[model samples]
Target: MKAKVGMEVSWHLRMLLFISFASSFLNVSYAQTNNDYDTPAAPPPGLSNCNGVFLTYSFTSRDKEYPHIKNATAQAWAFKSSATIVNTGEYEVKAWQMFVGFQHKETLVSATGATIVDSDDFPVDASNGTTFAGGSQADLKTSIETAGDFTQISAQIDITGTQFGVKPPGVPMPSIIKLVNNGYKCPKATMRGSYNY
Candidate 1:
């Protein structure tokens, strides 16, 4: 008779615990509904918003190499701006990294002004705390970052000298930005930036 009584008490306690959990979840959902009211509409097709972010580029590159695109264009989409505006404000619109250009034998060209010839794929480390959803801008940046940059032409490359260690790969010629930026009025050649995410 005592064991039966104990079991009944245990069952009641379990039922009470379940009811408590359900009530807690319900209150949380109710509270969050208030926060949702102030949230802006999801970013429109092009003119959009990142969650909790009014407007901003996760990363920006103001390289010294490509003078033309250096600080040429920014990447924050303005609110109420055109949906087609992927980049805006003040930013440098240099060519895409070479390895992201003609170098990678396969894969669609990244964007307009991208250098496809010397492009190479750079795999990001998911375990290294850099998170990237496939096809996101972050993914594209990874590909560009892995590509060797076009700067500081080593003497060994110019003369095939012994100083060249194992003949580090050379940046491709006819690269859209490097060539143009190099000869631009201010004469900048290559520029690069990295995103921590």
Candidate 2:
């Protein structure tokens, strides 16, 4: 009778141990699955669901001795540059405004195809950068059914006093360029070759 009682208690203890170990293993698996669901999945590859705006700033030429400067001792650098804005999305962007983050203390001598917003003069203060809006072409349409040039605006800007002071093959592009339109969500700019999209 004593031996039988001892065997029964031992079987009960073994069962209890097995149940505890199995439950712990199951809980760990459940927690891992729950965590996988909690995290957000990555976006699809080559997704183009949002409106797209691409800007290209090209450095045409640079002159170290700018003839416009009154002070001969002060260093003045002139740059002939052009900026192209392209709308590659499906929708039309009306009254499109662009922001140029020029950080080289440059001033705009003149600009065509786009005008400075809230300012009429060509000698706008662009030392800290400036915003531009379409002058005659104020709307950017979809790029569908386009051959060479899509719905785009090419602005030729003549600037002086860049103070960039860089060597050859060094372009004085802006630090950032963005589209400032109401009710539109712009994505971060990505570098492609020498342009930002």
Candidate 3:
């Protein structure tokens, strides 16, 4: 009789533990699934609603290299990417500033055709967000009357981090890309298959 009671008590304890674990797991899953940034909301109405300026980001390659940080490992992944901003509007865009919302804990290595505003620090901490503006050719003219590459600005950027996904929808992308200019707005970025320029 005593043995039977002990067995029953042990079984009940095991069941209780299993239920607690399952509840915790379900709570974690629910929290992760309820992320608001998973699908960004549509841009607000009014104030230059037209999508005249287009931005495209391309993941070039990933390389493993030894970083020169203080307490870093012998190897780390470096990401190479490129972005293009084309102004197809009727008027010229002067001193264009763009906001980049990089989610990974990345440290910028190099960038061309633009510079981070208000920061001379190399390898800028772009983990949260940063702004990039034109360096020399700050004005992006309209493409309506342009013949060559006068209506666009292309940038090449490199960073080092240990984030996953190198291609397609799995690739790490900025949560938001907005034209910081007063009268211009930008839509969310879209993913595209690998293609050469």
Candidate 4:
């Protein structure tokens, strides 16, 4: 009876340990998943533009330590026509695009420099440069002034976080065009239509 009881107790202990581990693992996974893709309740309020560029990473609700930045990701877009810069309106439509992404940090993690990817050209006198980095930040004004003619500026917002030797996750395309309709200086800025990836 003692031996049988001991065996039964051992089996019960094993089962108990397994259940505990499973429960703990599930909880941890849930937490990690929650941390990965939490975005803002509403897109952060910014001055929307007609020919605008948006650089975003995956995971909005990130921890304080790493914040909203990840590794291994990309972005890209294209515009239909040119936007004239001769008016003084709140904002106008200057550019349109479809974006695709793999992985993006939910928040700003680091301010390290990234490779500039762009292909936009503006008139010398009426130029307001724009950067078209695949899925990263771009100096819009500087980019417009650099092109030789009307063209698309392409760039890669590379993530070089050494925390895990990983770049932000690869964000696929399909990120749509966002209008910068507010805080614009030109009244006649027209937005070209969008082209797909």
Q: What is the lDDT of residue 192 in candidate 4?
A: 22
Q: Write the per-residue lDDT of candidate 1 for residues 62-179, one digit (tens) a residue.
A: 1122222323222111111000112221222233111111121212212222212322433221111111111222111121333422121100000000011111132212121122
Give the residue spans of candidate 1 off by over 4 A.
Answer: 36-88, 91-197
Q: Using Cα atoms with residue i matched to residue i, what is each candidate's TM-score against the true structure?
A: 0.21, 0.59, 0.58, 0.24
**Per-residue C-alpha lDDT of model 4 across residues 42-158, encoded as one tens digit per residue:** 432232332444333322211123344443222221111211111112222243222222222221223223321233232111112222222232322323454422122322232
Error of 3 at 95 (Å): 0.4
Q: For residues 1-197, could you state the per-residue lDDT of candidate 3 as single tens digits?
A: 99999999999999999999999999999989997868753422221344476665555666645543343332345777665566756777788887777675666767787788847967677878778888776878775656535425233333333433332234556677677899864555555453211
Instruction: Tell me the spans in candidate 3 whose CA falls farther than 4 Å from its real position.
Output: 1-51, 66-75, 148-170, 194-197
Residue 9 displacement in candidate 1 (angstroms)? 0.8
Q: What's the lDDT for residue 115 in model 3?
A: 80
Candidate 4 deviant stretches above 4 angstroms: 32-48, 52-197
Alpha-carbon local distance difference test for all models: 0.25, 0.66, 0.63, 0.31
What C-alpha RMSD separates each model from the true structure? Answer: 18.7, 16.8, 16.9, 17.9
Candidate of highest lDDT: 2
Better of 1 and 4 by lDDT: 4
TM-score of 1: 0.21
- Give the distance in Å from residue 122's predicted Cα in candidate 2 to where it truly belongs: 2.2
